[model samples]
Target: MTIAIVGGTGPEGSGLALRWARAGEIIIIGSRDAQRAADTAVKLAEKIGGKSSRVSGAENKAACAGAEVVVLTVPFEAQAETLKHIKPALRPGQILVDTTVPLAASVGGKPTRTLGVWQGSAAQQAAELVPEGVAVVAAFHNLAADLLQLDGPVDCDVIVCSDDKEAGKRVRDLARKIPGVRALDGGKLENARIVEQITAVLIGLNIRHKGHSGLRITGLPAEAYEK
Candidate 1:
């Protein structure tokens, strides 16, 4: 699938781009500045071997133009503006994955405390801003950025939530492509608020333990994933 990571210049965005690119998926790194996006993609491509042909960079709109999936990994503060900026380029058949957390991590406020989002959650806000045809899903909220940049596998469970069941499943399948990662259906989009809040708890755990933290749900039948 052709995946576009908007604000792909940041660590979270770049890390995901790197992993997906290494997995042999076509990746487009998007940035406000086309040059910066291109530069980052070039550097990242060199890291995984000089095969830069599969991965490229472009302005946000250009990146989303032909992508089958668009992931928004910008900070919470920029989420609204970024979605608004990309709204025109979003089409009805595409899926937009939102990994935004409404945390005060950027400000002086505690990371465990989430800021109030009038639209319920960042994913909900994104759903509201996008055009009718675009399906919005929330995921990857608790994945550690540092872990993503590593060459080894990541041990975690990705809980995917969306009002659109098919869109949510698509994202879950995409998440499963990552090594040692399991994807679980997290119900409706409204449940994203709960899923997002777990980020703060994980963040707090990471800080106290001085290590990257992740989630793993147990007791499910092993055959459940067969489908």
Candidate 2:
């Protein structure tokens, strides 16, 4: 699949771009600055080595225009602005995976506290701002960027939230493309508030433990993925 990571020049975005690119998917790293996007793409290509040709770069809107799936990995402060910037290029049935977590920790507050979002959660806010046709799916909230950047597999479960089941499944499938990453259904988009907030707790735990902590749910049926 052609995946576009808007604001993808940053650590989180670049990390996912590298993972998907190495997995043989086409990756487009998008940035507000076209030149920065190109530079990041070159850096990713250098890291991927043999799959260097699978990744490229473009302006945010242009990247959104060409991809089957677009992931927004920008900080919470920039999420809405970035969505508005790329809204025009989004088409019907395109899937947008939002990985935004509104952590107060970034602003000198407690890591376990979450800032209030007017639209409930960041994903809901994104759905409101994007055009009507775009299907928004919330995911990757608890992933550790450093772990994602590593060459080894990520040992964690990805909780995917979406009102649209098919869209949710699509993202779940994409999540599994990353080695050792498991995807679980997180119910409706409203549930994204919980998924997003969990990041704050994880951040707190990571800081205390001095580790890149990830989640793994227990007591689920073996066929959980089928549902």
Model 1 agreement with the true structure over 1-227: per-residue lDDT tens digits = 99999999998899888888888889999999999999999999898895567789999989999999999999998998999899989998999999999998756688878887898998999999899989999999989888898888998888899999899999988888888788898889998999999999998888899988989989988754532
| Candidate 2 Cα misplacement greater than 4 A, ranges | 105-108
- Which residue pairs clash within candidate 1? 92-133
lDDT of each: 0.90, 0.91
> Candidate 2 on 183-227: residue-level lDDT in tens?
999999999999999988888898889999898987899788545
